[model samples]
Target: MASSKKSVFAAFTTMEIVLMAMLATANAVMTTYISPINQALNTLGGPIATSSITGIYMIYGLLAYYIIRKPGTAVITYGIGGVVQAFMGTAYGIASCFVAAACYMVIAELVFAIVRYRKWNLGVLMIAGGAMVPIWFFFAANMFHYTKWGTSILLIALGVRIVSGILLCGLLTQVLGSALIRTQLLRRFAISRGQGA
Candidate 1:
């Protein structure tokens, strides 16, 4: 058991850790910059508009996972992003940021685990990305009282979020990862070293 824990920890080298931290920081900043867009969407179409772009907010961790191809990549990336967002002052409040991060981490980790962390195809990545949505949506519904919005509206909002997850998060991650691989900049990472490219 101890050796197993050590191996998991050892899977993340110094470079991977640094890269994950950088990605997390970037995610925090980008999320902040996009708040105005989210607000505008909320104003125009309520939560559904905001939901449409939900995948954009979630890309950081997924991107990191795509590159790293490890068990705890999403957990570390999302965890650091949550901490950074909490420190940087998100519109969603510190607690909510952590809750959202935890939500993303749980499903991402679960999806990877189900595949035994071996698959890195577009379908699997999309499953991981799209899966990250609903749990958080459930929490958000209760937190923001979306249950009062009626079943149809709630279902619509959830559908939008799930599609956003599939397209914006999963599809975008694969696209970005491929681009990065082509640049040869990520040659040091698992993605470039393995089947990901």
Candidate 2:
């Protein structure tokens, strides 16, 4: 077998980096402002209404990773978002939340790594979504110690994450990616692999 070398990022530009950072910061702000909405959901106390925070993070993470197509983009995006929250001051003191966010961010990155940057199929997208996110389920289970949900139930929740992610994040990100391609920003690379110029 011949030895081969590979790169991780999908030829990201400086502008892309800054935009991803801005989106991450915006995610942090949303998390902070949505605190009340989460509380309200928790008060509802049902399977359909348990949590919302982590899902928001996943939405932004998907967008960042999709656009940047780098190994650690998700981590940086999620980390910076959490940092913004920390700056704003959180009930959990931001440090703990940041640590937790980092853990989940790594998970999201791993899913993308397994698929490689070029594979943007719905199945892969869904897998990434389920692997990393699932706000309304796991967090509630942990905080409330609700163990009534079985593995099958968990899988169902995971399925929802996957589907939702594909519909919202994956599709939207692909649109953005296509727009970038149309502008020729990605032509230097995308042209080689894609059919038309």
**Top TM-score: which candidate number?**
1
> So what's the TM-score on candidate 2?
0.67
Give per-residue CA lDDT, model 1, range 1-197, as digits (tens): 79755543456889999999999999899998999999999999987788899999899999999998878898999999999999999887788888999999999989987876668999998988899999999998887789998999999999999999999999999999999999999988879977432
The TM-score values for the models, in the order shown, are: 0.93, 0.67
Say what the RMSD of model 2 is: 4.9
| Position 56, candidate 2: lDDT | 52
Backbone N/Cα/C clashes per model: 0, 0
- lDDT (C-alpha) at residue 191 in model 2: 26
**Each model's lDDT:** 0.89, 0.61
Tens digits of per-residue lDDT for model 2, 1-197: 12212454435667656766888777777767777776787578444353323345457777666655666777777777777778877755655567656756877777776665556555565567656655434664575455676766666555655555555555555565567667866544432245221
